[model samples]
Each structure stands twice: as structure tokens, then as C-alpha cells.
Target: MSLKCGIVGLPNVGKSTLFNALTKAGIAAENYPFCTIEPNVGIVEVPDPRLADLSKIVNPQRILSATTEFVDIAGLVAGASKGEGLGNQF
Candidate 1:
């Protein structure tokens, strides 16, 4: 199973920057509020030498690396709990 990590923070807080660095998804990280309405999902391969060694030893037809998912949710503004600034839809 793949692990998922969600990035949640206020606008212009480097949430997208971190996500992009982690996943290299090239998502738009604008300086304005509510720039990302829909969440962006990215899958990243986890590097493990043990897994590679096992794969080499077993010689599986298809070697699949462990993966992690990163999700970039829209920025939450003030009064978000009360349905403000992109609201609870996030």
C-alpha cells in the first residue's frame, strides 16, 4: 500500500513549494489566495537499498518500488471552519 501525505497550510506559506520539491509535480504555486481549488496528487518513489537488493536477488519480472502520495490541498483562509475562503470543501 502507498502512504499519503497531505499538505495543509495558509496561503503563500510554501505548502506548494514543499510539495513540488517532494514530488516535482510542477503545480502552480502562485502568490495569490485560493490559487489551487482542486487538490493536486503526486506519487513519489521511496528509495531503499534493501528493496533493490531484494529485487535483484529475487529477480521479479516487475520490480515495483514503495511509493508515497503527496496531496496539495487548497490554502485555508481565516474563518474557513465557518465556510469562508475556499471553505470546508478542502
Candidate 2:
């Protein structure tokens, strides 16, 4: 199974920074709204120090860890879908 998550909030809300920290994508901090149409998606490996310990205890053939994805979507303001102040066009 696969899972996905999206990072959404007001502009300059630090969404990209948070996504970069989570996914380590190193997205450049250029002009606001980088990739106005596309968002920066990052896949972050879950940090689990106990996975190996558990594997050793269980003597499993393999040790697997989970991962998470972070998406830095363009900021969407209130009533955006309704075209309220440069909202519908985006």
C-alpha cells in the first residue's frame, strides 16, 4: 500500500521549509510561490533506531522501516476556488 500527504497553508507560512526538513529535498528559497503550478514533493525516510533492535530480538530475515512524503503545495487563500482575489486563476 502507498500513502500520500499534502502540506497546505497560507503563503510564506514556512510550508516549504517544513517540507524540506521533513523530506530533505533542499528546495531553493527563491521568489515566493516557487513552481506556481507544481509543488515540491519529498519522500522522507522514517527515523527508527529501534527497528534493528526489534529485528535482532525477533531474528527476522529483514528489517523494514516506514517512510513519509511531504508536498509543498502553492498557498491557497480562503474562497480560492471561487476566484476571490487571484484565487480562481491559480
Candidate number with greatest lDDT: 1
Cα lDDT tens digits for candidate 1, 17-55:
899999998999888877788999999999888987888
Off by over 4 Å in 2: 1-3, 31-36, 83-90
lDDT of 2 by residue, 9-66 (tens): 7766777777777777787645565333467777777778988788888998876678
Q: For every model shown, what is its TM-score relative to the native structure?
A: 0.88, 0.73
Q: Which ten contiguous residues of candidate 2 have the minimum total lDDT?
A: 29-38
Question: Model 1 Cα displacement at 24 (Å)?
Answer: 0.8
* lDDT score for residue 52 of model 2: 79
Instruction: Specify the highest-TM-score model's number.
Output: 1
Give Cα distance to truth, residue 11, candidate 2, Å. Answer: 1.5
Note the clash tally of each candidate. Answer: 0, 0
